[model samples]
Target chain A: MDQDQKKETAIGSLFAQWTKSQADLWEDMIRMQFGMSDASEKSRKNPLHQTQKAYESGSKILGALISTLSEPENLESALKGMDSLPEFMMHITQQAYEGYLEFQKKIVEIAAKIGQHTEAYKFEGIDQNIFKVWRDIYEKEFRQYLNVPQLGLNRFHQERIARLIDTLNIFQASLNEFIYMFYIPIEKSGAVMQEKIEQLAEKGEIHDNFKEYYNMWIKTLEGHYMTLLKSPEYAEVMNNTINALVQYREAKQEVLYDILKEFPIPTNKDMDELYNDLYILKKKVSDLSRKLEESRGV
Target chain B: MSQTNIAVNLILKKLAETTGKAKIKVRKASEVLLSPLDTELSKTPYEVVYKEDRVGLKYYKPSEVKHKYPLLIVYALINRETMLDLQPGRSVVQTFLDSGLEVYMVDWGYPTRKDKYVTIDDHVNGYMDNIVDFIRKKHGLPQINLMGICMGGAFCVMYSALHPEKIKNLVTTVTPTNFDTDKGLLHVWMKYTDAFLMGESYGNMPGDLMNLGFLLLNPARLILDKYVGFFENMDDKDFVENFIRMEKWIFDSPDVPAATFHQFVTDCYRKNLLIQNKLELNGRRVDLKNITMPLLNFYGQYDHLVPPEACELLTKAVGSKDTEDICLKTGHIGIYVSSKCQREFGPKIIKWLKEREGEPKTDKSPETSRTPSGSKIRRETVKYVSPKKIIGKESKPASPDLKKAK
Candidate 1:
């Protein structure tokens, strides 16, 4: 092989040798930083299912709440069993936050290394973008968290209380998965950043072809992704987050529908009723038309 | 151009490729962008042979037909079946057609609120059954080859298990039959999912919500990197058109029927009933032992969504003696779309089906095919390592054949 061809092979081999041990270490670091690595099977069984019954009419919901709240510090006591905002906002989030910082360090290192090798495209400090994504998600989630203090037990209205607890549960779940959530964009950005390397490879920045460069990135990214995805923590957090959101939307929708019913105008429910009636009528008409046509041999 | 000038130009052209080529391509991009592009899918000359509600059976007549039995493609409800016929040169349907394989794809059309009552029984036994019967009657044959993709593959497995008499050969690509494994996060999340509540609340599972969850599975790549990569290659007309086609297929997901989703999660995913011979549909048990047809189960080596662990167990769990599991060197969608995968995937199925064709059709009951031959899985292809061995070792991560991933 020629000198340039040899160089490309060397670069390709550099990627092929990336060991599973390295992937495990990186995955562990990311999970540990987020407190996801510490989540046990016991922690996954958070009493989230019991909240489903809280979306009933105010009377039933209030009756259930009253029955539960008869015990001293019951709701607060249950909330205590789970990690509060302070635990994450103060202590548990530090390692995860630092993990993002470490991720930025790696991004910088990878980006600079590729930049030095190619001139087809300039990778202008991609680490900054990763950090920006991290900061933005954190800020947005914090704003969502700030809405929680207003939903205190002072509001005894059953619907409002239901929405409050559900919303808090979601907010708490978000806090728990904050690091991993932020890391998803980062995990994907690795490929985006690889475009710079690809441009370089095309422009003779690197002797190897763009396809080789892309495969290297895929191998690297897939390892980190597969490791995280296979974890019990990732599964638990994903399950909790989606379940919490589904419940929250259900509760909010019910409460909103009630308020909308108070108004004389059409709400989602009124429109849904009208639509359902229309659909059934349409189906009946179509079926009858089909029968008529078939009878006439059309 | 003189020899000296030519020599200088050769060196300069190489240098120009570094930066000059991109500028020239970008300048040409605007001209192509203004004109209408043909990004049409399911365009391989298919006619709707039969229609049942929103569901339609699209038949694509091939240029040449050498096979005895017709092949039916059962695609997942989550996304449109147009991925099979995505583009002119890159189409899976076209590939099969070029190889003299008659193709029929099931278009599980968009579900509405009215479809909330549709269950697995309604799909596997109802719509799919009708379509299979239609194909059989159309061909004047008793049985036809059945091929299903993703969720459709799961349905094919169910259908084959339930009615082994109707299928000559079964090919399930990127299908998840053994949902008990925790390797795939979808299985885990579904296990914990309150499907009953979600079903009642939404009527039908929202397509947008499903897309959001899918995007989260690989946020960095799916949400950001994909589009950015498209932007990077926007100058290439073919690349841009292909990107647009893929984008259309990806976002064109249909809402799943609520009852179907609930049963799928509860029975198949949470309870792990199907593989264990406990799932009941239409008052009859969906015994896996009934999947006794000549089986070719294909999965993407790098499929994170339906990991090999989720798919690999099916070859053994089923009672098929002629079962072959081929792990292609690509991810889920890439199994059909990727250039490298296209070379091996379609041809392999064509060959596997042809070998098992025109055999004396024996219509056997579920109990007759329950003979276990778990070790009969053929590993003749490139590097067939057991998914359990790789996924079983705690520290070692699953490594797909990455050289061919793109």
Candidate 2:
């Protein structure tokens, strides 16, 4: 969507929210006029003593909404919170790709700046792939850093977790693509609504009935999401994304268990094994007990 | 100047009016925020009949038992059975009891690391069978009414097929039976998923992760619009409380047992083996032809998770002569919670069950107290799939050598 259009949608949504309060007020008036509502029942449902609890809950919901609705730099940034979950997945995609692009830009700018003072470089073995060398060095350093005891993971298990995280990054990246695909409708409707809002704003048009357009925008987004949800590709992507995440988790845990094996601690693996044995034994005992009781005519 | 002046006046007036309303809203919302919020869910009372590791059987003793066979509500391992009795008036369990039916539900509690190896056989053949036997012994009946929802519905279909004699009548709401159809995204996705890798990763399917997957399925509405709407409607104590309750349920998903998840995705979703008579539990095959009891299959017309294509084929696939189906004009979850659906869902289900149970149709009034809006339901089609023809289909495939000789 165009910048103006995006702004319109954001403003329109705010106005729309305000419009809902008006509607609620209208309802309250209608109820008062009719004297149809039961104050006793309402109070019974929301006793005076419950005001504090309601405030806390309402504040929580409001706080969450305020945070979520805060204007983002772009649609993608809006969706991607600062250093959120997708980042901690150990593999980076959005940030990494953007980071690489920015890095290239910075390097070129630095080179250009340096050229003004002196020759940019000696161009010694310039024919070699420089990118690979840098990438390899970075990986090796990152791996080493991961092995540091202070890094949270033991030295032996860091490599394994690193590998898992990297593998998981590929899966998460693909999953992210699918998730972003699911957002296309939201973006589309938002754009359309934004465009209309912008046009109206430019024309200084009086949108007396903003509620209808607001509802349309929500419904349009919902309809699009629902439609996209049924697509075979969406399902495939959604399914594989989870599997990928699970694979990474399993690898990480396996590494954890391996490291835990040398120590005197009780590991997840040991617990799982014990649970399995106990479950099977429990079933056997239950079945035998039932059988014995049946035989004894109990 | 005239047009611009008029527009400016209108805009100013509207802005002032909106600001005043906004103040009221903040005040009302603050009042609600400060007030005690009872966002309680699953308020219906029930006692534990049996417990097995992460699984338990809950019995909601009826005020007066009117049915010969007790009803067993089997829920999917992924979500809690609390959804059936989500709220007072909206609860399926409540509706059943109010209609004078014995209600019992299987609660597949949160699975731990130890539960990673529990397979489909352990669930349907082992636990479900044992539960059925226990209920039968308690009630002193030969059979019971079996109902399932979503994955639980699939389990019911499998259980009914494997042990037709144990179920007097079957009710499946939004159950995905025929997985081969490209009706839903879950089917398509599961086809390519590495079930073994998933099972190996976490002992049980992480409930939170599964919940995340569900959120991703409808990101636009679920992640954004829904949350915004909740805040917008925060002034309404009822709406806010209900929203919180729903949030609690949506997030209360249980991590599925690894073995069960593995088999479900691979055997059912990937291979579409159950409908094809190729699915095996423990050592025996789950033949859909064996589900010969009276069946009432419910499906939402617009259920994205389990579409009509996923549910409608069960009658054709099964060997039930007295099968009925109700396709409600709602989504998967709406049938249980939507105000429009509350009237049709519980009432229709109860009415159908009552008719099959030899009770008069007019025993209870229709649940049409509220003006029925935003909903439509297709009448049940009692289709017949002769058991002999369906079940008697030879299990043996044609021999290669014999074919060559011929």
TM-score of chain A of each: 0.35, 0.44
Worst 10-residue lDDT window for candidate 2 chain B reads: B397-406
Worst-scoring 10-residue span by lDDT in model 2 chain A: A118-127
Docking level of model 2:
incorrect
**What TM-score, over all chains together, does every model reach?**
0.61, 0.68
Real A-B contacts recovered, model 2: 0.49
lDDT of each residue in B1-406, candidate 2, tens digit only: 3232126667578778978988999899999988999877788888998987667999997788777777899987766777777777678788888877888899877777877877888888788988999899898888999999888899999899899998999999999888887656556556755644655676667778677667655555566656666666778887777777777777787788888887888888878898888899877888888988888789976676787888877877788777666777656776776666677788777777778878677766433221132122354332543422221111001100000000
The residue-by-residue lDDT of candidate 1 on B1-406, one tens digit each, is 2122123455456666756766876787786777788777667787889998899988888877877899999998888888777777668888888868888889889898777767798789778887988899889999999998988998999899999999999999999888888766677667765644566568788887787777656543555446556556676677667666766777787889887888888888888887788889878898888888888888977676787888888888788777877766556776887666677678777766766884453333111122255424433345655653332221111111111110
lDDT for B74 (candidate 1): 95
- Model 1: DockQ vs. true structure: 0.07
Predicted chain A of candidate 2: TM-score: 0.44
Could you report the DockQ of all the candidates, in the order they appear?
0.07, 0.20
The prediction achieving the highest TM-score against the true structure is 2
Residue runs of model 2 more than 4 Å from their true location after superposition: A1-191, A197-247, A279-298, B1-9, B193-196, B359-406
